[model samples]
Target chain A: MKIGMMSFAHMHAYSYADSLMKLGNIELVGVFDDDLERGKKVAEKYLTKHFSDQENFLRTEMDAVIICSENTRHKEMVLNAAEAKKHILCEKPIATTIEDAEEMIEACKVNGVILQIAFPVRFSSPIAQLKNLIDNGELGDIVAFRTTNRGQNPGGWFIDKNLSGGGAVLDHTVHMVDIMRWYLGKEITHVDAMVASYFHDIDIDDAGILTLEFENGVIATHDASWSRFAEYPTWGDVTIEVIGTKQTIKVDAYKEHIRMFTSGAKSLSNVFYGNDMDFGLIQDFVECVQKGKEPSITGFDGLKALEVALAAYESSEKNKSINL
Target chain B: MRKIVYKKLEKIDFATTTAKVTIVKSADQLTEGIETFLVDEVNFDSVINDTDKVYIPSTLLNVVNENLYVYYELEQYPFFKKIKEVIVNPKGVLRFRRTGIITENQRLIASDLVVFSAILGEPLTIQVKRTTPAVTPYHTIVTVNFGNGTMAHLEYTFSNDDEKIELEWSGIKQIIEFNSAEMNPFSLKNYTSLPLAYSVDSILATARKADQNVLNRLEEFTSLLSGGVTK
Candidate 1:
């Protein structure tokens, strides 16, 4: 199968290339970047043919396209890709706005092409296990959950409101929302949020907290921020604690249960962690394409996550809970 | 071909923050005894530019350490300043990554800390490698002393074509201790202490959440394992 890349500006664009390369069956036709220099640089690094113009890249005889552009540009790119009848692998936080996300979803549907969001976390072995546990009724019903995905502050176009839409809240919160929907097997009915700019002085919020109530009455709280430093042992983690009617499951990923702290300072001189989910997710995406099945993380899934993020932001702005 | 790998490293613990970079290039591209500061002074550009190449300027870098001040002649010009000489200990390069107060304020970015690995060259394929459990053979575990205490460490064997590989985690220890006088147990050879801190222990919380999420998803895998695709 031939696959083309739409943009390389997004952080995951390189990863998408890496994924496509590892899958083997997919031939990378070419890639385009908004800036020719950056595009060429990325194409060189990934060793793929690159097109300087978007039109030229889209016109390639490719079976699919992966839209790994900025949040705001996703809609137009998706629409353009759909017009070309290319199945899509758009990155998460699919669009900065709900309208754009809806438009992209509709466009993909109308084109009769699969539109998958790049929510690779769902494909992780552990996360897949979590889904199984829920489906098997091991946890019974989720009572309350708290999720977080913090990291060091990021710069570039991500800090610009016009380019990235919102800051940490928009970029980070969407993942939690997506995972929540994935686990709850229900929609997020309402949200109460508190957004802040306590970290670095940027145009957008560097931190945010959201309270979510699922349609099934299960509640959850999420914290998304750029909180890591150069001195901390670990960069970030995503954890969930669900108090279901049956059991309480907690995954302690960073507990170097068997680690050595250097000196009197425990600056995580050495950490024992693994990042195996990436391979599994890529394998699943490739299989989905080969089998003509929808990707594990679909465009509809991407829209649902964005909807929660947008609702949280609107809720934070109004100082009230948003009803979804 | 040039490659980079993280080894037994040491770092400093601060009520504030800092980053210590140790770059050893196979190519003689690096100037010997050069102290480059990658400060995440998030808003440094909007603030001030050092006239002398004394300190490098970056908008995304922060200056969290205050103890050791390395001086260099700033290559001052109309537009930007370049580093002429960086006066570091030559022992290791130090720069601030973040602070406690700064870390406390940034609890909103807890969703994007995922580690997704993929191949760099031809044929175009991607896969999500498990980032936990230190799977043996491919990932090895060793002991590292960060000065006053013990650290359980895991290092992965390098694949032939890994362009960029990173270790990610949630930093949530109450009081971190890294500065040791005698041997300086910190890993001076590598970039240490990539703090992933968040408000109210967001890191561990998120990990637990991810665990549960994964546990729930495992049912599907279990079904596939059981030769049953139908729900």
Candidate 2:
């Protein structure tokens, strides 16, 4: 199978490209970025061809393409990929708005192509085990969920509201929301949120706390903030505490790491050597495309998570709970 | 002759106090037990003053003591031998709605003393507060930077009756958590359940020595209280 990359705006593009190259029976055709210079640099570093034109890149006879462009550009790229009949695995929040997400999904449906959203946390081993326990009723009925997804702000484009849709609320909330929706098999109905710019002097909010109510009567609270200091062990973490009627389960997605304290370094760091979530995601996408099966995580899943995050912003602005 | 003397002393007016201590492996279960003890066993009437209360609100000494013991054990391993620093970050909510006239600063000092004594080996660094006006239920999260990259990520909530204490030693490969009612005592179970009956004589001797250390600190804290209290 041949797979092309759409852009390198998001940092995960490099990891995705690396995973694609390492997979068996799959060829990473090349990469295309709107900024020709940036595209050339990434292509050179990965030893792959760089396509300056979107059309030329789409016409490269690839089965699918991974979209890692700016948040605002996802809609156009998805539409173009759908037009070319190429399957897509787009980076998260699907698109900046609900309308665009719906349009992208409709376009994929009309073109008879698959559109998968990148949610690597679902592929994590610890999360998979927790899901199994939840599915088997080991936790009884989940009463509530408390989660935190905090990371340092990736300064440039992420902080620009026009380029990235929102701040920590948009960038961090979707990952945990997707996992919660999947694990609980429920959709969020209402969101009460508080968003602020506490850490940095960015135009967009750098911190947010959201209280979400789901259709299944499960209420959840999420702290999605860019609150980690410069000397933090890792970039960030996704920790979820599932409280149930019978038992409770807490999962730290990045716990499978070794701690390393060095004299040269300012703070102790964690060296993770766990299962490669990105590789797992790419493998599933490849197999699904090859076997004509639906992806475990679909575009609609992305749309659901995006809806909650968007609602959080609206709720924050109005200072009232927003019903979905 | 000793039994007759003890019986005679029992007739005198002596202060009596009750304490319920539970050592659990998981800090998550700490609250349920604590709450139950507070409701059923603790004599609120007997607590004539804040100083008389054995378990101060938000000090989280139990959680820190638990982590410190684990850190000491983990240090024995070759992996943690080279560690030189530690950090403790304790963030939690303190529900002060029911307790009239308590302030966030008082609760913070109580909580800070526990952490300071456990990780820093003393409460000398904690500053006393005066005029602690009542604070509404709020979240208290403080990060302790024990210089040299040893840090603790302590996150807790002392508001609304929901309690959670999570302590992570960044320098050491250990995480001690006490949330809600789930208490997996982890390594503390052994020390808590040591064979007191078989080694009663030796244990008593050691307890006497430890008691002196406690009394000395009590004296120091009492003296500091004069200057520490808010006017």
Q: Which candidate is the best by DockQ?
A: 2
lDDT per residue for candidate 1 within A1-324, as digits (tens), equals 888888877877777688778877778888878688888887888778879778878888988888878778888899998998888888778898878888888998899988888877676556667778988999776665656666667688888888889888888887767877888879988776656665566778776666677777666667677655556566555665454556546553343334557775544543645554556666676677778996778878888888888887887677566888
Tens digits of per-residue lDDT, candidate 2, A108-156, equal 9999989999999999999899999999999877766778787888998
TM-score of chain B of each: 0.17, 0.30
Candidate 1 lDDT by residue in tens digits, B1-231: 111111112111222323333344322233445443233222232223232121221111233222212111111110111111221111111111111111211110111101110010111111111112221112111111112111112122222221111222222222122211212234552333322211111111122211334333333323332341211
TM-score of 2: 0.66
In order of appearance, the predictions have TM-scores of 0.58, 0.66
Task: State the TM-score for model 1.
Answer: 0.58
Task: Mark the 10 consecutive residues where model 2 chain B has the least summed lDDT.
Answer: B1-10
DockQ of every predicted complex? 0.01, 0.04
Stretches > 4 Å off in candidate 1: A252-266, A269-273, B1-231
